[model samples]
Target: MKLIGVLLFSACVVIATAVQQKDSELTAYKESFSPLNYLNRYKDAAAVRQYMGLVETGKMLSRDDIFSLFNPCHRQQMIALFETLYGATDFDTFFKTAVWARDRTNPRQFLYAFSVAILHREDCRGIKLPPQYEITPHVFLTTDVVRRAYQAKMTRTPTVIPMKFTGSVNNPEQRVAYFGEDIGLNSHHAHWHMDFPFWWKQDYGAVKDRKGELFFYMHHQAVARFDAERLSNDLPVVQPLEWDSPIVEGFAPGASYENGQEFPMRPDNMQFADLPFLTVQDMKLYEGRIRDAVSSGFVRTADGRLVSLNSTYGINCLGEVVESSTHSVNPVYYGQLHNDGHVLLSKVTDPKQRYGVPPGVMEHFETATRDPAFFRLHKHVDNLFKLHKDLLPPYDLSELEFPGVRVEAVKVLGTCKASTPNQLITYFDESHIDLGNAVDTSTYKEMVDIKAVVSRLNHEPFKYVITVNSKRSANAIVRIYLGPKYNWFGQKVSLDVSRWGFIELDRFPVKHTVITRNSDQSTVTIPEPKSYPEMMSEVQRAMRGEVEFTYDSHYRHCGLPHRLLLPKGKPEGMDFKLYVVITDFDKDVVSSDVTVDELNHISSLGYCGVLDGKIPDGRPMGFPFDRRIPNEEQFFTPNMKVLDLVIKNVRQKPME
Candidate 1:
């Protein structure tokens, strides 16, 4: 019996020693294997040093050159070169190879360019990554919280403002920053630009289909969503930034870039100024030219040739020109309206480079939404697309009607006890995010979990139940949308006006038999393991054999965060309308030649488009909402209706 006890003690000691060794090895691996370690070597390269010196001297890189580096116009070439050298491999292998061959002119630009390539790669599709690692890192890395934390670790000083929200209540606009300037939303915007880049690839295979149309639809939808949030908070919808007027709503981001440099704040009521490259007159001139193109039904190319805007491709071409992509009908003639406007507004406070201030939030995708001007700017841009869309004939009943199908009733039910049928619940919930994951910690002996409690708008999970009347079990495409029932001044908005504000909630094929779906299951909404902690918990559980790790299954490279599924509503329940429409699935699916696996996993298909280079839906990007309603009103018959609903804000206690 004594020998048996001695043997058990010896076995326990051996196991404990092995566990320690394994953990030590893992710590070493993490320290050595970070992307920062590889990327830091290029910071001192001659090209990067030269660019840094130029930036320090207040020499701005040309708009085209800046975007080219940030988004790398030769992305396909970079990827192909990596694959040729390293062979097809996982993201870690491919990313490392690409980094080695990348232009070392700017470390930040290289980081943004390569990370974007990895996120959009077919092999890396649906890989579940921490939000910081995914796309939000671009924003988070620049935050005072993250910067201070990293600096403190290096100097052994206590972190100042380690994890606090940045903007203050100096103005009403600042109050809305909690929603408008969310890291996740900013990340989504940044990712969208990476997905639908302005720089066109020489190889057609590298370019996404309907790129121009998606540009219009995506930003248009953002404006719609912004309007919904505004109405919920008792604010009017965003208005266009008048070219001749002084901008009243000023922004103080109070945030920093990845290099710990704070973005210069634009004072209140700042006016647009003339720059050496672009002037107020130049902007007005470009606007007039674009307006002329819209009215004349054609745009003049750089070579003085007229390009007709009357065909199906007309809107696409117009979108390219207005957004001023490389594929624009004529970049020099049409002018870079959208891009230059952002640059000009971003530098309004220092247009002549007098202050030596870097461009404001509007200068880059990751920082753009932090400014109130961004929404107003996009509102104006959306109007440009609307002008062209209004010219197109409204959809007839035959174009919209789904034969032999009708939606009998539509209802939304919430999971929480406080939730009422047909009413969704939203609230200001505080989430504790660990910024440690975002910071580079190669030199640290132990990983620091710097936590910050940020207040954000969240909604209780809900389900949609739809009663369908159909004779056969055919597949039907379900499109769900949301819009305010009334305008800010308490007047019912016309369908024509409300149509522009409609935000797509979900789009998926439902069998005629299946009528119920949880909000978590919505194609437009991602399911929760919603935060870094939640994701890490699952990984821990899988390691301990408590749960099977379905990382690949849950990987969604593109989609809005699940927490942002609902717009923030008022405490007293804001009234809104939920619109549901069913179309024949057979007619909606687009035929494509490019092959990709698990196309169904590409959630948010309505907004994000298909990964296989095909527009998933056959109709116009927004379909029924893309065009005006028919005057006959036959299309709105019992098949689809605006169900009245309320969104109430609930107070949520912080989790322990």
Candidate 2:
């Protein structure tokens, strides 16, 4: 026993020493890994040149061939690089490859490629990525803030600065700018793209179950949520962008690149002209073909087979084709409608780049939503999916009915003692983000913290008390949704129009007569993101085996920010409707490998699909609601109920 104990102690000491050495090496490597290096401030040009020469000698794309991911060839080049990174045998090798790729890849492309690689690679799992805003503060924070942070770091005096919402009250569209320009909201968008990258292939070993359908549902939800915000701000719903007409709303993002380059602005009434490759006529052609496919109830595959659009996989197929992912049935005939639309809108101000200006915010996913045009563009995209859905057969009375269950009533209870029942509350809150990582302080020996506080819309915690009368003990899936009570014209919203405006609130399983659900436990959103320092500390502990870590938990950061789940309601209380539906749980097709306990943990299985697994819900993503309503009276079954309510913005002082 003594000999065994001695051997074990010596072995542990050796292993600990090796782990300490590797950890030290990683800390050093992170200095070069700083996303700010992409700005060229701390870039090593000789290292980049050497790396590019080696890659070119191997017959891969030259540096010039890969600049913007908007280009098809550039996207392909990035995929190749990502595959190389994923193929690494261990974490050490992956780290080395990432360091090499980081310096040579274009700054814009590096952001996507590196993030996607981190999400897909097993060795990189559980490793927390620094938030993109911290990586490129220039894009999220105003240039003035970034410049001041640098100035402060040089002077050895750090300070906290407050970041106000971008636009003024003059522009009516700017009413919801706070929602669109939110740091957490934009991070959610960027992170979702990383999970379901358009370039992903099945050969990569991880099949994104219903990748196409998920692509459709996620964006659809975003557009619907945006419409709800618009109605809250007393603005009309977003109008679809027209291909032939001039864009009326102008947008200046008030953001810049690290090289001191301001994002180009689009003037009011800017015309859409033909670029060298894509033209307005081409866009129209793509739209016409897509419409024809949906109308005919079939889409032609690449090999010339007509696939029916009426099957269980119909929506999924259409999603892939519309998003133009690698899973698209016919890329040549269908064309890249969604992607090219972004390209056309992005370059309207500087189509040729003859003025030597960067493209507008529309060009990148991270910064895209800051502009009003993004919602308009997605509204058009949603209509395409809606066209297909409009033709689907309405849910029969049998399918809609939950025979043994009836929802008697539903009410929301706020966390505050003075709060009223059935009334959800919203307010403005401020949170600080560390900008210490944004500034390159390699030359300085001492570490200094630079912080910025951002004001954003938030809501008080609330719970749902759902009264149910069940004839017998049985299981069912409960779904909750919220929407405006009136339309843009102040008329009572009809079922048809209100259908598109409803955003899903929560989805869960129930087996009793009474159900209580907390807002923090919502399935549609994850918890608010942790601070930069907090995330770093947690990741280090996970690496040292001090606590449990899983890829699913890591993915929690990719969902909608819990704080922004409810739109900013009127101070006097805005009228809204809450719709609850209970469906047979036996019919819900969840993967066998996923245990109920595993799912009980934080899961955004609705907005963001399960990583490396199937979506928990068996029904089409927006079941019962995905299709058009045949008759409003007949649509309300015993198992479903709608409650009238109001969401009030309880005014309070700034959080800071």
Candidate that scores best on lDDT: 2
Q: Give me the runs in candidate 1 sitting further than 4 Å from their true place.
A: 1-105, 120-129, 133-138, 141-144, 147-167, 301-308, 311-313, 437-444, 527-554, 592-599, 630-635, 653-656
- Index of the highest-TM-score prediction: 2
lDDT of 1: 0.65
Which portions of model 2 show Cα errors greater than 4 Å?
A: 1-67, 537-554, 590-595, 653-656
Q: Which tens-of-lDDT digit does each residue in 1-656 have in candidate 1?
A: 33332322222222212221222222322333423234333322333333334444644332223332222233433333322222323435444444333322233344444445545556554444455422234354346566566676777554434344455665766556776777667767766776676764534245477777777887888888888888877788888887888888877777665545567788777888898878989889999999999988889988889988866557788888988787887888778889887887888988898866766778787778767888888899999888888888787777778777878888898887656799888776666655554455555667555555566777788889899888666777788898888999999977887888988888777665447877776666554335555655655565566865443533444566677778887888888889898887777667543122333556666666754456656677676887776563555855575689998876772222
The local distance difference test score of each candidate is 0.65, 0.75
lDDT of 1 at 317: 88
Clash pairs for candidate 1:
126-555
Q: Model 2, 337: alpha-carbon shift in Å?
A: 0.6
